[model samples]
Target: MGVVSVSLLRSSVFWTVDDLQQAAGRPAFAVLTQNAGPLQLKDGVASRRGFEEDLSALHEFITHLPAEFSTPCMMFTSTLPREGSSTIVAAFAAALARAGSKVLVIDGNLHHPSMHEAFGINARVGLTHVLEQHATLQQAVQTVADLPSLHILSAGPVPPDPFALLLSSDLRGLLQSATDRYDYVLIDSPPAGRFPDAFYLASLSNVVFVIAKYGIVQRQPTARLLRKISTPDLLTSGFIVNGALGVSE
Candidate 1:
């Protein structure tokens, strides 16, 4: 099953109008599309000078992922607080939408979720409410008004025990349901050292995207996290070295 389903490039869902439409801001809408007339990523701005080349690499990377991940890849990303995991996660998601995949980005960092703020989405209801109140994931999810293929699940409100909330029977079920519906699930998790949320996501996600700044990913927590996960199949999806934006002098 893993080998036959792992190729993202071969999936019919990866190339369709429905994928882009779903990503057009419905967090629960998990279709990163390639079959539309022509895909156009809407929400965020792409880096003009280097975006094309950058995403070329990213696209190659995503499509080449292990064949077992083809059914729908589950990748959760996080970092130490202030490591810019949000920036990287959002960028990668936007890129996926541009390429033609139905993408659902759920802000799982309940303690401090910024998905709403980044997209200018009004979070009247978010993950917290969706899980606690048994609300519809579609209702809490908002469409990226201008972006054709981008959806987000905002962190609705702070929960008393965020760990229990994320690992809740219902929320986990929702995540499972999401996999069958979307092409890629890029979850934004809290810093590994600071909370248990990362652990929860690490346990369930097929892959983990670890973001460490130029100098900040020390040996302690990262090693600890790697050890904590402790499974060969459970892998680090990617390592993003961030915070090198510069002024071309």
Candidate 2:
């Protein structure tokens, strides 16, 4: 997310906002609104619609993500959730749709999930149900509107054993299933210090990319924690600094 003016979506003149933002030395992946509010046009304040500028930039961003990584597995973390991992992952999925890639965004942050909220999906049935083996894939998967190729599986009601579920064989099978169904599986995991659920999932991913805030403290013990996750196969490791909250903000 980044500063956004909905009206700018309609103007070919504003198409280069991506380059401008990237030039600012802090490029962002924006989850812009579908509606561009009233703006000055020849017919007076008019709504802007049918523009793909923001979405196109987002597509470029997520499409190149896997290619940039050393492995297919990607681990994303935030110094904390408020720092922006969920937003990034969800938007990344949305943009991935634009890039002609079929993507499934799993809300792996069980303690307090946000994928459903970001996508405006019902939180009653999803990955939680699937992991519990209580729901079929069709019953759990929700298609993102306006983004035909992007699907979301939110972590439903927080289960008592999110960690156990992370290590469940069912999860592994699900990942395998996803690999065959989609181009990429983007998971929105929890903060490193908040829980170890993500660590377990990261081990299964092709690559793991971490997330750090522009400025935040990670109180977790570094060496011991790193040791627990040590693995030669873990690749495509990187960190992103995010601060934006909403498109209009």
Candidate 3:
């Protein structure tokens, strides 16, 4: 399993590529450092230059990946919550949409769903509603005002049992339908090691990308989590190192 590491950097954060290489024991796939304070979207489009540059780089990396990595559905998870996987998923989806590829971003993190806020859309009805048969996919799916190619499916109200809902056959059907309609589907899932939700989601996705906080995430635990969740039916794409800097291109 060859792993590619991507470093997401903040302006003030400073760490060397060697630091990450030593920690992950893998070469870097791409280095994306942004001085932009936070992701800012205007009219459902990336407003900040730095953020746009980073997204462009990420999109380039994904496009250049091996032919086997080309898939309609991709899931992004992290070693733990708040590692910035959700932001990456959103940015990547927007990048795809800007390139004229229809993209759907699913907020699979039912426990602490926030993708709705990112896109400035309503989350009152979404994946949960669809899974529970409370709403149809068309009713729950939201389109970005300006970015017509981009769509979002928020987590909706927190379900009583998120794991149970994710495991339902309805979830599979939803993904299948999404893949049929969209050129790409990006799912933002919960932390892998902290919850079983990521594992189950990974099985349903064609490719899984684990996001690890550069300094905070430990190698052994991350490695173990990858091993536990990986299956022959799924492709574990690689690692995305969040919050670090100073890497040669």
TM-score of every model versus the real structure? 0.72, 0.66, 0.81
Off by over 4 Å in 3: 1-29, 35-40, 43-46, 64-71, 247-249
Question: What is the per-residue lDDT of model 2 for residues 156-222, given as tens digits with 9 covering 90 to 100?
Answer: 9998888887777488788777767778788888886678887787787765545433323232332
- Residue 246 lDDT, candidate 1, scale 0-100: 38
What is the TM-score of candidate 2? Answer: 0.66
Comparison by lDDT, 2 against 3, better one: 3
Residue 213 in model 2: lDDT: 37
lDDT of each: 0.60, 0.59, 0.73
Candidates by lDDT, descending order:
3, 1, 2
Per-residue CA lDDT of candidate 1, range 1-249, in tens? 777775533342212223322322111111111111111233332433454444455456567667777634444443467766675566667777777788888888888788887777887688888788657887877777756677888888788889987776576677777777678887888887788778777777877655544333443445445456535566434444343243111
Root-mean-square deviation per candidate: 14.1, 11.0, 6.6
Instruction: List residue ranges in candidate 2 displaced over 4 A.
Output: 1-73, 218-230, 244-249
**lDDT string, candidate 3, 1-249, tens digits:** 123233332322224555544544444443446422243355333554556665665566667656764545888897877777777777777778888998999999988887888888998998999999999888999999989999999999999889988787478888888887887889999888777899889888877777766656666677566666667787445566655554443
